[model samples]
Target: MSLVELIAQADERGLAAAGVSCLDRCVPLLGGDDEVLRPLWASLAEDGDGWGERVAKIRGHACDAATGAGAEAVSGPRSGPGAEAEAALLARRMLAAVPAERSAGALREWADTCSVAALDIHRLLDVADDGNTSVTDCREGRTEGMPPLVTAELRRQVTVLELLAGHGAAGVRQALEVSAEGRRVLQAVVSRRARGRT
Candidate 1:
């Protein structure tokens, strides 16, 4: 099934995992370490017992990281930091916007939002054109001639939802592993961009 269909049919846990997985992969843009969102993943394993608290704690860490990156970088569009800063802000917003309720309706909205935001982050950081002007088309499976980064991101999104749907709670750890791989890719891309600027 398509990602939108998968998300529409997903349970509360699936939706949460889907949203968290997207945010987890984009952590590098927020200056987060590889394991920064691990606690949130763990919460998913236990049926979302402490999701709100974990989200709050991670948001705190993300705020600290974003602040250290510089208020100018995150707050100003014309200050010359450009796409990287914009991507960071987007990633930060993804974490900050995570739903406290974790209800099916709330998580569905958050998952859809995170999916778009994560794709936008990838598009911003990707050096090549992603063909489509909006990432929404790519999410809906209109992909053709997509850039490497965007293509990989779309694939990751599909993989995550499928894992969660097919395995239920058993898929959470595998989802984390998938997200970790994406995080490393983004970290490398961020590092390459930094090097290019110097």
Candidate 2:
């Protein structure tokens, strides 16, 4: 199936296949348009009109990938090219792109909310070989009622992705100006990654 098809299936079949909350979660991750991932994402978003089945396949495939099933998780019908898979791939790609500090916050406040309509994304996103992130990261180390990982860089990245994907506000320009806090967070991720390389 495809992402669009999976969306329709959710609408038609209820949770027997994919739950409503599951769909809500993936929307935020699906929206980001970093220069690194835009070209790849554009292809998924533009899989032609009436491309429902195509989308369903993507979601199923993505779910499979998350479960470590490789790409053979959900197979049946080609769907509309790889638009759904591409969207799914781009979502994971950008997720990997996130600055570590902000991942927990973005997932908690916006992406993981019931509003996004996809909980599976959060489940997969929650899975980190690095450590028990996602939900716990948002909970365990909160400071002043704020998540320790919710740095300015994470917020900016979330904002940028939300805006670019047209999932937030009336415009996307909000995420572009960038912020001092965001810059510092990104620098920190880069610095940390650099150190790990050595």
Candidate 3:
């Protein structure tokens, strides 16, 4: 069964039987590769339309599963009377199964670096996705006359990316570079839009 199917069935059966109150406990059993249910995702991914979203979800769930498994390795079905222990065990296995490489370290690093600045990579992603590069109202194409907040945020993001440019996370740094490029692109688009608007 696929991870989604397993989760849906468990939800249908109810949390009492599923013992899945939190994402931590719920994700371990998501259908995928042999023991991991990862394979199921690959099959689903072959469809391709919602690939990035699906993959993001899969990776997030996998990370959650690793956390669940680390809490406890549930051997059998929990449903009903045996739910608490089963939940704990499930969490253990889920937590344990997550590999260290799949976004965890980089995300942790990124989050840590950006925490003080409050300009997380996720925020960078939001900017990239939303097509906003305005130093003032990023989404609104208000670049030439950006507010203090937007410019500060942009500068902070740029600084962090520059810092992370080296280190071991080349891919992450590459993404940062891409987002920086995006900011430049957005600046241009917003400039054009602003010129048109004005």
Best by lDDT: 1
If ranked by lDDT, best first, what sequence of candidates would result?
1, 3, 2
- In Å, residue 187's CA in model 1 sits off its true spot by 0.4
On a 0 to 1 TM-score scale, where does candidate 3 land against the true structure? 0.20
What are the Cα lDDT values of the candidates? 0.83, 0.31, 0.32
In the range 1-198, model 3's lDDT, one tens digit per residue, is 321222232211121111111211133223222233333223222322443454455556566644533234334332222333343343334333333332334333323222222222212323233424332243222345443434544443433333333332332334334334433443443335336535
lDDT of 1 by residue, 61-167 (tens): 87887675623454433223577778877887888899877689999999999999998888887888633546867878888777788889989999989998899
Task: In angstroms, give how far residue 89 of model 3 lies from its true place.
Answer: 33
User: Against the hidden reference, what TM-scores do the models get?
Assistant: 0.92, 0.27, 0.20
